[model samples]
Target: MKGASSEGRFVIDLPDSDAALALAGVGNQTLHSIEALTGASLVIRGLELVVAGLPTQLEKAVGVLELIRPLWQEGQIISSVDLQAAFKAFDKGYKEDHASLSDHILVRSKRGIHLRPKTIRQKAYIKAMETHDLTFGIGPAGTGKTFLAAVLAVRMLMERKVERLVLTRPAVEAGERLGFLPGDLQQKVDPYLRPLYDSFHTLLGMEKTNALLEKGVIEVAPLAYMRGRTLENSFVILDEAQNTTSAQMKMFLTRLGERSRMVVTGDITQIDLPGGVLSGLVEACDVLEKTDGIAISRLTAEDVVRHSIVQKVVDAYARKDS
Candidate 1:
């Protein structure tokens, strides 16, 4: 049996080349995750590993290493069962005390909106819709900000909470390169709003979604066309709010009419605005945070509902920012 120690080089002598390869694959996954999660360094030499970190981190790494050892046995397939077990055990031990979004939105219907969030952020967002005529969700990406807002807008339209559903985004490109596109205004702007199309297809299915669009019950338009009209008694969502300049944002907000609500969602980290232009979403958040009828909820990487590794990467980037 290989000895478990406080700090040292460890060698797990293997029987054959296949076993060696399997062990190395598992080790690489574990080491990469550990380094990403805890800023540890792992140096691997064949079957031997030189792990350098604080004692507790090294102990945790060793524990993970030992857990994957049996799967590396000759003729054993390092199967999904082993990986699931290891990840599940680690997840169980590391209960995410950070608030999660498993509460407010539920996956009631089968096809549309697969995720159900039951956390404070989601409830707060929903409540903001109920109370305020306009709310902004500014946070990191993959935090269910845009998706949940879209679902809520759909529900409002379906339940007659609002008269219509209006979805739009800024048609800004990486380099102001709209003229180079292969189509006219609507077609050119369509690509920027692809995410909205995807969400709509998932929620309403293709035929009904098309019918609703034709009837104007569901409108997908570019921000430029939004300048002349006011949206009333409707649920309006401005996805990718970071791309909207402060002036554009204010114009959109002022276009809100009676019995209407606007849910603006964006990741400040991903702002594609011109170098000096401040995002309307971020500026609105700063100005309206303490206002009576407005709500702003910020989500972190911890609120990411995607793969666990995504959370690790987001956290690593956030640390780098700090």
Candidate 2:
């Protein structure tokens, strides 16, 4: 009651009971964003947050907070209108130079894309993709590592900046062991690349995507298949790059021919390579970070795009590691 609104008044209706409980998990997020945006305190009790600030700033904060309410507990499909509106509400002067991709890719109104990265590192990742021909988005799981890469790749392909799209991921098994994963090479690698397929399917629609795949306009393959290949005039994405050894990463990087751009995204935190083996993605990042043409983008737990709880989960583990 201390910080109860003076003028700003709005009620946020969550979807259901599950959403309400989920919202509780991220109660602090509202507080943090309000403090950052309005220079005021936010107190949340149950599903309601009492935000005290100047009326105009509080109203703006209220609207921006509502845009992400559905995402407090779990990832939801947020409409383009909602995303654009949120961007406007969250706008602070000239858009940060590090948010180029976010500024360019207009998510269709009412068509939800499950991504919400709220840190300088995450914004840098978007900026890198916009400026580079070959980029490595390296970070931890749930950090929007692969999904954001795929989304940018799709947007570039749609804009004709690239002639086609290709996605590939290493098929290495972590602990479960893939010895019994069924079928042959394609079957084995399919599971690892399924996330890429899911994102593409959601963004491009199934029929058109299938048609593109059939015509070889969109190709998804195992990391091994990328060997001895030269990709030109295409937007190629390599997911799960951490599973790849140094040699394989080198080969994949070399495959970037003229006029082609590639995005190799992986979480070094989840590399599945053997103890003595070095991950190519890990190595490439070190080397490329020193180079001129290539871009190296790093995302942190603060950029987790899943549920807000997912961000906390990542942060908890990071603290343990430290």
Give the number of the best model, judged by lDDT. Answer: 1
- Model 2 gets an lDDT of 0.69
lDDT of 1 by residue, 185-222 (tens): 77878888888977877877888888999999989989
Assess every candidate by TM-score.
0.67, 0.70
Candidate 1 stretches with Cα past 4 Å from truth are 1-107, 110-115, 174-176
Could you tell me which residue pairs clash in candidate 1? Answer: 101-117, 101-118, 102-117, 102-118, 102-119, 103-117, 103-118, 103-119
The lDDT per prediction is 0.70, 0.69
Tens digit of per-residue lDDT, candidate 2, span 211-278:
98899889998887988889999988988888889899889999998888888888888777889999
How far in Å is the alpha carbon of 311 misplaced in model 1?
A: 1.7
What TM-score would you give candidate 1 relative to the actual structure? 0.67
